[model samples]
Target: MAREYLNVRVDADLKKQLQKLAKRENRTLSNLVETVLGNYAKRKSS
Candidate 1:
């Protein structure tokens, strides 16, 4: 699939928490967020 940029606004606390988790998992925060959004879009489309 072709990739596009998405600019989203999120709460600071949530962003920090996710950033920490992403670091621990050895993944970029953008990759983590994309995984979550892709899963959500697929589930909602079904």
Candidate 2:
């Protein structure tokens, strides 16, 4: 599948938290976000 970029503004605190969580999970920030969003989509569809 072709990939596209998404750009949005978020608060500094949220970004920092996400960065920390990604580090703990051994995933890049983008991968973490993609995983979370993908799971959310799956749940919503179900």
Candidate 3:
């Protein structure tokens, strides 16, 4: 799939929390966000 850049504005605290989770999961921040969004979309569609 061809990926496009997404610019989102998030709170600083949320970003830091996500960064920590990403590190623990051995994933980049972007990957973590994408995974979270994909799961959310799937659940909503279902």
Candidate 4:
């Protein structure tokens, strides 16, 4: 699958938390972001 680049601005604390979660879960930043976005879409749709 092809992926496009997205530029988003987030706070330092949020970035740090996301990095910690990615490291703990052995997931890449991209995958973590994708999972969060997918979940958000599902919740909003329903």
TM-score of each: 0.83, 0.90, 0.97, 0.86
lDDT of each: 0.94, 0.95, 0.99, 0.94
lDDT of 3 at 32: 100
* Residue pairs of candidate 3 with colliding backbone atoms: none
> lDDT by residue for model 2 over 1-46, one digit each (tens)?
8999988788999999999999999999999999999999999999
Question: Rank by lDDT, descending?
Answer: 3, 2, 1, 4
Report the CA-based lDDT of candidate 2 relative to the real structure.
Answer: 0.95
Model 3 lowest lDDT segment of ten: 1-10
Order of all candidates by TM-score, from best down to worst? Answer: 3, 2, 4, 1
In model 3, how large is the Cα lDDT of residue 10? 100
Model 4 stretches with alpha carbons more than 4 Å out: none
Deviation (Å) of 12 in candidate 1 = 0.6
Listed per candidate, the RMSD to the true structure in angstroms reads 1.1, 0.7, 0.4, 1.0
Clash list (residue pairs), candidate 1? none
Candidate 4: Cα lDDT at 10: 94
Write model 3 residue lDDT over 7-43, tens digit each, in one string.
9999999999999999999999999999999999999
lDDT of 1 by residue, 1-46 (tens): 8989999999999999999989998999999999888899999999
